[model samples]
Target chain A: MTTFQELRLDGVRRRFGGKDALTGLSLTIRRGEFIALLGPSGCGKSTALNCLAGLLPLTDGSIWQDGSRLDTLPPERRGFGMVFQSYALFPHLSVRKNISFGLQMRRLPRDEVRRRTDEAIKLVRLEEHARKLPGQLSGGQQQRVAIARAVVLEPSLVLMDEPLSNLDAKLRLEMRTEIRRLHQSLGLTTVYVTHDQEEALSLADRLVVLRDGRVEQIGTPEELHNRPANAHVADFMGYRNLLPMKVKAVHGDTVALDGSGLTLEGTPVGPVAPGDDVVAGIRPEDLRAGPHGVPVTVEVVEYQGRELAIEARTAEGVALFLRATERPSPGDRITVTADPSRVLVFP
Target chain B: MTATLPDRDTSSTRVARRHRLAERGIDRQLLLLAPALICVLALFVYPFAYGIGLSFQPAEGGVFGAYRAFFTDAYQRDTIATTLGLALPAAILNVAASVPIAYRMRGRFRGKRVLTTILVVPITLGTVLTAEGLLNYLGPTGWFNRTLMTIGLTDEPVRLTNNYWGVFFSLVITGFPFAFLLILSYLSGIDPTLDRAAATLGAGWWQRFHRITLPLLAPGLATTFCLTFVLAFSVFPSAVLVGDPAGTTRVISIAAYHAAYEVYDYPLGSAIAVIMGLVELAVVAVVLGLRSLLYTGSTGGKG
Candidate 1:
């Protein structure tokens, strides 16, 4: 039996012909840790996941699973259970058969295989639909079967590649909770890949944000969300208000910025100096309607269930979007402000 | 009643009547099938009906004379078994060889189109050309024997041509490309991720193929088998040129041809042709029946 300890990816690189899909990814995953590889499409998150599963050979570098070199092994030898975005359940097989596939592949005893598959089906709450084929089941049920298939193998590491992407929005949310519960209860070292930032933030113990086939940043959800490494990351992490400004003054931790419609005091992230051209980023929620701020005419207002998302233009026609508890209509004049700590200045 | 009704209602009824006429106009879309329907009627149905009529009017004895003669004569009856022996093995071999080959070529790769084009060259060569090529190539003093001698595997030239094997080989060469193309398309329809998923689940390559790929591909294989069998069962040119036609390789089609043209027994030939067709249909039906027994589930995408 393989003990749960650490899976080390040391300089994982994958090159397709002349083009590099995954340049080099090196990360250590502790046992029971949920790691989310967050990136936009074509950022090599899937490629990295495939490499970890040994589905794709690395152009360079090595992987170690609990001190044993893993890169040289075939995918079957890697013993990783993966849930695909398309589910990829053998359409010819029934739900029970699909769930029991991995166990049967391992040549497990008949009774044990049956018991484990039954338990997994129950765990996914798909016992009623066990006899039906994947095509006969709804999208949610198929997803549950896929999850059951992967986890039934009882592999220390589970690799999920945008598993919820094919589900409807409501089903996606439901399955997200189901996945999180599965991860916590089973204590699986899960490496999930997704383009959705919110999904990565919600489920991951640590998040690795990638861009252009490279890791932009890797930290806990709060760390990456609060202290983004650069402007690209800040923008991706829902810092929607990225306004250009000239740095008026720099003191200790705060830098003052002067813009046509937005005069803001922001925390310095990287190097900043007086008179330097910088971009100040503020999240929609961070910007609120208050006094002693830039007067802007609201252009669009969106109702976001409990709050209003207001898009406005400044006196000089710079666009600003802010979220407020108070209702504001379009074409209304309002002043918005940002706390110094909430504002991030990127040069 | 019409006079009491409004003018609007009367005009609307007239329009509705015209719409109903259009809808009932012999299903306008079926007119598009005119060329295909005509071809089937003229080429297949008329010829088949004429053969059936000719078969019933026996040249001697009674109306069932030709069929009775075929069943009573051991020589004629043996042709059915001979044709089955030749066609069944040839079709089975063709499908068996192509399945693995097509599976390997299913995925996209460099020069795939070129490879497929080269592989299908034997298909266009036809039975006549292929038989002649095999005669020259597999003859006693041919390069194949020369190579065998040079390799020192055998001192005597191996007898490959001028026998049942010659015709079998010809059928394989000619029919393999057709089977390969069909099976390749079927293999391509199956999702590659299914195999990958199986692999990650601890299945080895052979296990994945045995358990997953083969089961999903069974129906397609059955179809390829039926088509290949039809191609092989009607063995005329190859049997004459390559096989020992009068003795060991005397297939049913040769019996039909011999009876019709050589002996001037058209009714007997018609009866033989009918029997041949029935036998082929029976084989195809059996294969289809076996296919039904397999898991013929949908291999759709994104599920």
Candidate 2:
């Protein structure tokens, strides 16, 4: 039986043909924790996950599981379950055989293999389709078989690389909950990699946002969404409006943006003094029409059922978007404001 | 029904128009295919029909006379076994040898293209030339044996050419590349992710091969064997040049050749040709029937 309390990645780096795919990635995964490596394409999130699974060799540094070196082991010896973006289920094998693959590989007793495989099938709710080939099953069913195939081995950690990316929107939502439930019920530590921030935010206990092969920030979904480390994270976190502003004054936690017809207040993130240039980030949901605020002309309004997503331009010709219940026509002047906490001022 | 006269008229005209369009399309396609169809009829079908007819109308006792006489005579009947003994081993060895080499070379590596190109050079140089080249290099007292004796690996020159072993070696040299190419194409069709998935599931290289790669490739291997067998079964030029045609390596094709060309016994030769085809067909059918027992799963290239 394999068990581990924690897995440590000490400055793990992967180089591909002289180009660094992952650079100095350091992370500690505690037992039963679901960590997400979230990034756009080519940001090394997949590389980090592959490194953990021992799929890709590390060009620099090492991975340790409970004080023993794990990097030296082959992928088969690592004893980690990895669900590829493609699922990678064997096309030739039946669902039951695919699930029992690891057990058979370990040379386990036949009855024990059958018992574990059946239990895994039950866990994934695929008992009816266990005899079917992967090609014979639906896409959602195939995804479940892939999950069942990996989790049947009872690996200490499960790595999922965009497992739901191929599914339709409804199926994706359903599998998201299913994956979380499995992780919790099985007590399996998970490291999920996805470019979708919403998936990472909802599924992971903590999100590690990577950029250009480096870890940009690592925090909980709420923390990263509300309090981003920089402009890049802020943009990714759905703070759609990032207006360049000059800091007129810094009073306590809030800094006032210079020359708004009505003075706009935003909380400062990095160090700032008088007359310093900074970006003011405002989430579309946070910016609301108030009695007194920055005056702008409504340019385009997209009716989104309950709320109207209004696109407006400020007096200085800077474009901004905000949601409002009030229906506004084009060329109508409106005032929008955010609370000091909602408005993030980044240097 | 008479009240809906215009609607029925329009529907009937539409059906007629559709039929006319289909007929026109088919006619044009048939016209374009005339040349190739004529070539096949003249070259393949006509000769095949003629041979079957000539084989039956033997200058002998009855309609079954040629077949009966060929089977009754020990010398003529033994040729089938001789042919199978040579062809089966050559085909099996070629395909078996190519499997590991093709599997290993499936992935890209330095000098891979150069090596494959060099290996396939024998195929481009046809069977007779390859046999001639083997006769030069691998014959008794040839440079190969000279080197072996000089190095004291063997005292006497190894007898390779002018025997059954010579023809077998020539067949392998000429036929290996054909089998390798076919096997390589089959191996390439399998998704690489399946291998990775197997590895992650705790399968070592050998386990992964026998269980995963071999099963997926079984159907393709069966096909490669049948094609290679057919080619080797009809061994003619190489058996004469590198093998003892009248002695140990008296293949069926050599007997058929002597009957048809040398002795002017066309009916006997035609009967032998038909028998040769029947034997090949029997082997192929047996192989295909056995191949069905393997897991002939889709390679999932679409996925």
Candidate 3:
């Protein structure tokens, strides 16, 4: 089967006064795919989403959908559903009316509007509160109403901007699964913007990591988690242990590092030359107490329910993190080892 | 002190002390409010009660005689219709006209401050000043008619002053800015994100305004219209300056003035004043009741 590109953003740029919020950002989205724009605040994730939704005009570049121009269209003519961070529910309207708003705008038959509204209300499981105003519902319930309102339109694409950020931790988790389930069942193309890496990692089929108004990396969760393209990507992927080292030697696909009386070898994710300064990254979970690598002394041991995180320092005073199922006491000496394939070297 | 203590006596004394402190606090609060209370009673309440009493005196024939005469006399009764005819349309037109202006001016732009200052000038010009300006501006030889004639829009200078339209135009000019300012505040208070969301949901500009903005502003619009109507209804100086006081524009206020000052009929004047207050109250109640029927409590999210 051949996949068709449903949406294409070509070199989209947005400038605010003298500053560039998004600079030549480009992406292609396929049909029925869930994509996440993940970055910290001011990284231009929301700007990119608004540009696609036609809420903000791009300074340059054209957006095409199915080979036709979309950038020139007005936001209302785009026929895309968007859920804002605040839910943006009409407080004066009942849940049913809110969900049926788009259908009414389309001038659908009254009966059909009613039926579809009922179906959407049931989809979000908000039938009991269908007649209640947004103010009467809880935060989670209001979000469900927003989703129903968006989905009832059966739009070609849905854009969500930090929709789960306002919810509590537990609700965020539940809604993450709920969103994934909705995407699967409806098979709707979606573009979600969020600052939470975990949310992007867990909810998205493919995560696009953005930094400073640029795309850092784009890949599946496991791929990006196991193999980040650079030190910044690795750091964002929960690789807490970063060490500055000098490159001792470069083998065809791998590089050897020497720093702080420690020598190690790892695959070079980026270009590196012998005698070049580089940053080495490793996840704490990948480092274990074994007999093959660096020797260090345990300084602090933190008890996480499923695993223990041991903070240690090497003889050369380099910081390291080791995860073990059993707790280790402070002042205990141990050798921590990491697989060379799991290590990342960036020049 | 080794002596047995009576808990009831001590508790009662403690309670009494707290009661005295609370009384002192309330007394201080009342003392602070005394000046405002005295002013209201002396300036508003006393005058209002005195007028009501005067309206019911025997000089006007009997307790209900003046009211009956007001309703029975053809000329006096016609004033109610004439006043409402002018005031209602003027108030409605002011509110309707201000909606779009206020809506367009809600967002910021280059000349927004200048435009706002210009729009607010009419409000600062009180009714008397506004009436005087209208007489000069809308008279047969004034610039308005001169321009119309020069442009060949009319062969003759239009009869704009000393008529019903003269007073009507004056009311609109003065009442519009007040209405616009009120509607603008209401429009700004609404969350703009709601309209954005509506737009993304496939609502066009008119649909968004009609379905979302208008419904939310209904209460505010109704209130503004009621207040503007009251302002237009109590027309005295403007009616005299721009209207044919002896003929077409003898509104209730002019009638009350004539009865009290010209004819020395204080009871009849007070009766008309009492009637005006009752009519204004009735209109306000009806408008507010209709507003409640249209929309419930505020729709804006937890302020």
Indicate the docking level reached by candidate 1: high
Poorest lDDT segment (10 consecutive residues) of candidate 1 chain B: B294-303
Task: Chain A TM-score per model, please list them.
Answer: 0.97, 0.96, 0.95
TM-score of chain A of 2: 0.96
* Cα lDDT of model 1 by residue, B93-208, tens digit: 99999998998998889999999999999988899999999999998989999999999999999998889999999999999999999999899889999999999999999999
TM-score winner: 1
Task: Estimate the TM-score for candidate 1.
Answer: 0.96
lDDT of candidate 3 at residue B4, scale 0 to 100: 40
- Tens-digit lDDT string for candidate 3 (B6-47): 777788899898789887774446688889999999999999
DockQ-derived CAPRI band for the predicted complex in model 3: medium
Q: What are the per-residue Cα lDDT tens digits for candidate 2 across A181-276? A: 999999999999999999999999999999989998999999999899998888888899887878999899888887433458989989988799
Worst 10 residues of 3 chain B by lDDT: B294-303
What's model 2's lDDT at B118? Answer: 90
Worst window of 10 by summed lDDT in candidate 2 chain A = A255-264
Supply the DockQ value of model 2.
0.70
Question: Model 3 segments beyond 4 Å from truth?
Answer: A1-5, A248-266, A287-303, A309-337, B1-4, B7-31, B58-60, B299-303
User: Which residue runs of candidate 2 sit more than 4 Å off their true CA positions?
Assistant: A258-263, A315-318, B1-27
